[model samples]
Target: MQETSVTKRFNELFDKLEHCDEDEQRQKIEEMNEMINEMDEEEFEYVFTTELFNKIHEMIEDKKISLENAILLLKYIGYYKVLKGIRINGFNESSLEEKFKEIIYDENEKKDEDKNEIIFVDICECYFMLNNQFSSDMYPICAPCLLNVASSKEKKEEAQKKVEVALLALSNSSTVNV
Candidate 1:
């Protein structure tokens, strides 16, 4: 998988760290090593992409990326694939089923806090849209979208920011909200 390249690159960086005694470099290497050791290729790719989406969303919110371009970026990343008519892979048919079940179970035992329904709705719509466009409808909106949507509204500066967050949330593979 492509993630192996990421791991290998990290290893090369770690080797180079030996030439320097900086605590920060060592700490970064240790963190990277730990992540590489703990996660498989699929998980690493999912997490990496999710983190990148969040960072990009942050840039958009900060006005580093224009709203029109942000929407364009969303299209480039496959958000509009549903409208284009793509099939989504079903969770039950994927290896992520067990992990999904575990996460749902944990969430079910937790208390619900008052949250913004609009953001949630937007996220759900975005998920469905993307699922129908890029993958298959069997794909459910995952946890990351739900969490990010709920949290992002707290700092929303414009309508476009909310939409961007919703798109970013849709891209994450963590949870699928029914």
Candidate 2:
């Protein structure tokens, strides 16, 4: 049987993600984000189905991909879902939150000065994009993680961007009435 366009594109993206180095993974992620952004609402909803989210989530949980890349992929998906006004149907919000919390609360991951800054930035963006879906009660669990990233002095050049994303997550979380 021939592969469908969605399947083909998803496989291509995932293949690149699995095989690439850190910089190449980032490039592929950016490309994937652009492709998602260009999709119309119906198309986006169709392509990014519950099964797709589950597959990606499983990859993250199984440690098949780096946390940073997984979060970046989730961030873009959340952003496009919000932008397109698409209602999440079969996506598992609880599992996603659990994964986010695990990554955020992992002290060892934060202790890595070389990678923690970008990881936290991506986490904040993920939270911001999915703010409406997450409860305000979850904010406390995430705020301290963001604070740690914001205060890190090793990456002075990227500090502002990190701080901005952290603030964005906090602001969105605070304002969520749901």
How well does each candidate superpose onto the true structure, as a TM-score? Answer: 0.28, 0.63
Error of 1 at 171 (Å): 5.1
Q: Which ten residues in a row have the lowest lDDT in candidate 1?
A: 91-100
lDDT of 2: 0.63
In model 2, what lDDT does residue 28 have? Answer: 81
TM-score of 1: 0.28
Worst 10 residues of 2 by lDDT: 169-178
TM-score of 2: 0.63
Compute the lDDT of residue 14 as modeled in candidate 2.
73
